[model samples]
Target chain A: MNRLQNLFANKKSNLLSIYFTAGYPELNTTLDIAEALEQAGADFLEIGFPYSDPVADGPTIQQSSEKALENGMTLNVLFEQLQQLRERVNIPVLLMGYINPIVQYGIERFCKKAAEVGVDGVIVPDLPIYEYEKLYADTFKQNNLSNIFLVTPNTSEERIRKIDGLSNSFIYLLSSSSITGSTLNVSTSIEDYYKRIKGMELNNPTIIGFGISNNASYTKACEYANGAIVGSAFVKHLAMDDYLKNIPEFINNIRPRS
Target chain B: MKYGVDEHGYYGDFGGAYIPEMLYPNIEALRAQYLKVLNDDDFKAEFDQLLKDYVGRPSPLYHAKRYSEKYGANIFFKREDLNHTGSHKINNAIGQILLAERLGKKRIIAETGAGQHGVATATVCALKGLECVVYMGEIDMARQAPNVARMKMLGATVVPATSGSKTLKDATNEALRDWIGNPEDTHYIIGSAVGPYPYPEMVAKFQSIISFEAKKQLLEQTGSELPQYVLACVGGGSNAIGMFYNFLDDESVKLIAVEAAGKGVETGHSAATTSLGKEGVLHGTRTILMQTEDGQVVEPYSISAGLDYPGIGPQHAHLFKVNRAEYVSATDDEALNAGLLACQLEGIIPAIESAHALAHLEKMAFKPGDNVVICLSGRGDKDLDTYIKHFGY
Candidate 1:
């Protein structure tokens, strides 16, 4: 079992995952941020490699991606920075981005390099299930990388079952049918959708994401799934002064330590 | 091999719905319903009626006498510029608006480069009494001020896309985000033959009336349905695809697509996509796109706002790969000069985008009796500012 499977096997609930853009704010801060997140009790983390067109992201993530790109973050540079990942960060790391860059980098080379760099999984939102299954499934499998699939409120139950079958780590449940950074409303309909997915009792765990901004939302999300992920909110936190020093506080704010 | 999209939404190895899960239901809904609605008797009658009465269809195929004499060929101009909104963009807008109504979508959203598509979408929305929103790049709004004004006058909200080169690509990205946010109520009327599966195929079908009319008219005028050469300028390739649609099966007719080479193809500033691009995904469809070595989309430059896009439609990409059509480019100066030549010779001022195709005539050595047809995709009225500044008029 890989880091992702082992983590999911050991921990059943309240598994907090954090997401941030690599090379954002500065160039050499990628590993630094990862170490800080790991130290601050993030169960797993998704390091976003910037793409010029991030259509699925909201303003906060967009700005961070732009800043990351401006800081000269490329997959080549990202991989070089991640060379020492296993030394300091023990939590499962997933590389998240659009599919074009991965295609440009050569899918085989990218997956092999991700494995070499101690990356556990990947999350490509725009990479459709059809494409992943047909083209890159074997490459990911060969690398022991969990290719995480997202489930939205709009996703059909049949498609969700298909996604669950393909997935080995966990399913990413979008808080709503919206882009990143939206506030989790937890409306009656949303609750029903959550209930429907929960009742399925799929083989994989489900981690709610895309708007678990605070303790209240996080708590509400954990009520329906295994855990919650904070992306745009954490990226927003990273923009604050002395962000590295305050990583622990940020984690505490989401789920205060007993 | 067929030049049409397959059951899987691919035109050869290109084209697919590579959108996020947020857009799956919307795209899937459109995918399932588009063909059924398009072929329905009621939908066909309504679409045909709108094309005839509202959009002024059967836009004439005029034989350009002076252009024929100058270019040493029987040159004809397919007059898409005479459409109601001053461009062929209205055809797709009307078709999509009718489709949106049938699908129960309450609002319409679109992205524009030159604002021709924006104005067209807004015009159709007003006709249907639906809310309209157009995302135009901040720079495009400044360059194409008249079109922006026209969209506003047509009762559409114009939102400026202020990210990543601030051009058509960014506007498209912004429009997509808007669609993701309001998936149920909003129907995105993607202006060009770009975007995911059904969009590229759908836009091409709506605009196919160009070739459909041209073929009938050409046969009547020249006693031959097939022209020796057919030319159109390509950005996201909607107009070019439409112009090439009916004639694609006629293997004898030579198809030529012109792209914008801002300064020159070798120069860093150019939108000559097939010339400089690599195979990749952009705007949700797998196609050729101008990008850096690291896969960042390169900002494409062109004097014509309509052609200032970094990629072409997936059909165009497939056609390029299969060698079914000739892809060429003309620089800004060449297009500008061609625009003037058309004004003086043919008594018609073509849109700068169309002028790119016209400019290529100077480079080709045609036989005296070779019949050539060019798609004059839009009028030059929106480009008067650029024309005046270039000529110092």
Candidate 2:
């Protein structure tokens, strides 16, 4: 069964999802990172497409994105890497980016190519669910791709379920009100949010993202629900290159001690 | 009186599209059809009629006796204050909506800062019975509640943008995002004269009608076609462009643009373009804008909410660089005083947007018989809320 379909069934193990920008430390390292992540025990990996304006990201991810852009990443290059990376990695590789670049890239053509490239899903941070349904819902279903939506703490109960219903896979729960890598800890706020959604009868499962920096932070997130997403910290490690090969040890330090 | 845009869509050096490659096609499409549709005999006749009957134009040019005597100079106010929707925003809104209808665009979207543009857009959309959606910043939505309520009552959806800095620039970004998503059916009703190519040109043309009327009024009053000096405020530089369009080539006339010096130009809180901004690409074209070394857009601050932009219109940029126009900056306190002075002397409330222009008259020597015409852009009723908040009035 699909990861989302499994949630609807009896088994409900907390899923571990990881988000990392494509072409971060060096160009053409996307497939290697994807293979490494899946082996290191990640359930799903969101591949961020670098954008000029990323309003919701924290400082860590923002720096990572800038580095990715500096290394000269483009949509065409990302697509090429994804096309090749998807063949080697079995886990669902979700493409995440802002709407403007994709809109300029041609939505229908992008979806058609995603189908041919082995992308399981796509998450656009800025596109509202209502607009997606009215405009591009068919394109996603046609491309055999799941459209992921996000639910924030400020999101109402009814709105959460509505978005969850629209979202095919688990909804991406934005950890805090601000961007990623913000100094403020999202623990209490995130915990309260997890508890609130736990009772709301969500249409799909939820994965926590943004602000999962260290092992203590990651474990605190896992305790609340599904495996927490580690974006900025991993991107930070990758940016330093020498420490990237040591990611397996980092995962061991964060993963279940067993 | 002539009320048409100039050949190059400039009021001398105050208007032009300074955009980049990404926006070129959209601008080109609009440019190709704008003049043809705006000039169609039927379009002009209907537009002129609406301006007269609905908006109540040819609005009286009232002489501010007390203001003139106090300042030791004559001041004639072009009362756009009596227009139906309360500001010069409606002038462009009415024209653009008419243009959109002519272009066969099904829906219209607008971005507003101080809410004047959105209200005007919503008012026109309601009149035309077309679907309208206005994107505004969450902060603006909160601060400009009355306008938001007005928009909703007019049957336009107000989308509160939560992304970026919650202000006009962010709202514009959101609206642009929407346009990129639904390009086929949407006509972006740009609030001011900044955007990718044709928008800056098209909006300036629609706004040009202001100067066209001012010219006739000034000529009749002074018995001359050219005044010694003409002045207006700059945000996206629309009102100034409108007032300057016909007078661009009138070499005898001096064009002066007043910019917002929120605190001061040296302080970060100023929106004074020529004083601080460098030549850079913003909105659609290359213009003077405040930016970082890496080309990131900086948030602008100003006491006048309308003038809080890091960039100026491309036409203004060219004018500043070519030294064709005289540019001045007014402090926030200066604008407030001018707002009070106009109200006290003329008994006509002007919008804060227009008061920035009024503030500059104090800084210059209006030599006897200089024949200066200052545009009284809009009424102050909508800004009463802001006035009370700012002064505890």
Return the top candidate by TM-score.
1
Model 1 alpha-carbon drift over 4 Å, by segment: none
A1-258 per-residue lDDT for model 2 (tens digits): 343444335435545667788868777888888888788777678888876556446556666776787787777788888777656888777888766556557789888887788777888765655457866899988877888876656566776767777877677776664455544276666678888877776767667766776677777666665656777777777766565577677667667636
- The parts of candidate 2 lying over 4 Å away from their true place are A1-258, B1-25
Question: A176-216, model 1: which lDDT tens digit per residue?
Answer: 98989988888999999999999999999999998899999
Q: Which candidate ranks first by DockQ, i.e. highest?
A: 1
lDDT of 1 at B218: 94
**Per-candidate interface DockQ score:** 0.89, 0.03
Per-chain TM-score of candidate 2, chain B: 0.93
Docking class of 1: high
Restricted to chain B, the TM-score per model reads: 0.99, 0.93
